[model samples]
Target: MEPWPFDTITPEEIDALTDEEKQGLDAAVAAYIGECLRRRGVDPAPPTSTPA
Candidate 1:
């Protein structure tokens, strides 16, 4: 995977991204988080049902 695009960004900078760019960034962030969780032996799956 490629390196992350930015080390830090302001809200205005995020707001300036195009829809496609925003989607790409969102996916990248999610993947990065999932990988980190996996490395820590944490399950990343969502619960199958909500708690009562």
Candidate 2:
């Protein structure tokens, strides 16, 4: 897989989220990035996602 371009995330998404939802989304994003780094040289994380 490739690195995600977080720097290019759209302003539309910023506007779409409520303040509380945005806080949770930000936490989820940080977790995802940490997960990506941890898997960088090892087997990929399984795709059985914990859904919203």
Index of the highest-lDDT prediction = 1
Tens digit per residue, CA lDDT, model 1, 1-52: 8765677876779889988898788778778989999999999996466322
Clashes of 1: 0
lDDT (CA) per prediction: 0.80, 0.72
- Model 1 — which ten-residue stretch has the worst lDDT? 43-52
* Tens digits of per-residue lDDT for model 2, 1-52: 7665668787688769998888788778868876887778655455465445
- Which residue pairs clash in candidate 2? none
Best by TM-score: 1
Residue 36 miss distance in model 1 (angstroms):
0.2
- Give me the displacement of residue 14 in model 1, in angstroms: 0.3
Candidate 2 lDDT score relative to the true structure: 0.72
Candidate 2 regions with alpha-carbon error over 4 angstroms: 1-9, 41-52
Error of 1 at 20 (Å): 0.3
- Candidate 1 lands at a TM-score of 0.69
